[model samples]
Target: MKFCLKHGRCNCVEFYQGDLAAQADAPYILEADYKTWLDVIAGKLQPIPAMVLGKIKVKKGSFSVLAQYVTASLAMIKAAQKVGIQ
Candidate 1:
């Protein structure tokens, strides 16, 4: 899945879910283990806090760039929770 989040605006964000091979490219990609991702989508963990605990890693892009989208990032998490992953 690919989620495009704009600054402080969750409503305008774009999300896509499908085969990995068909997914669109994103400049920044947040990487975590399957369990960690599930925990996040289930609202059992928070991304930033997880990163602080070394549970999540930014496999692409810089921290500074990702930091600029914190609000949108959280918004993405909230949206993911609603997807009924659990």
Candidate 2:
């Protein structure tokens, strides 16, 4: 995921099978403002809904291909929740 913190400055975080890395070139990139990401991570927003609403944008890969990983995506969110965010 590439988070657009502000302006055009962005940071990328990569996740693979529930593991996370500080940076990596992922096949699929999801881009959105920092606040939008916060909302999603905080469980205030659903990723799919956010994407549909345009709060999130796909910067790389195809949506159809990404959709195949919905389960993994949700699992990532769940794991993040378990780790908590501060």
Per-model C-alpha RMSD: 4.0, 10.1
Worst 10 residues of 2 by lDDT: 13-22
Runs of candidate 1 with Cα error greater than 4 angstroms are 5-24
- Residues 30-83, candidate 1, lDDT per residue (tens digit)? 667789988887778877888778798766568776777667667777877777
Q: In angstroms, give how far residue 77 of model 2 lies from its true place.
A: 0.3
TM-score of each: 0.65, 0.67
Best model number under TM-score: 2
Q: Write the per-residue lDDT of candidate 2 for residues 1-86, one digit (tens) a residue.
A: 43323343335543432134224455566777778878877889988878878898876678877777677667667766888878
Backbone atom clashes (below 3 Å) for every candidate: 0, 0
Error of 1 at 75 (Å): 1.4
Positional deviation of residue 83's Cα in model 2 after best superposition, in angstroms = 1.6
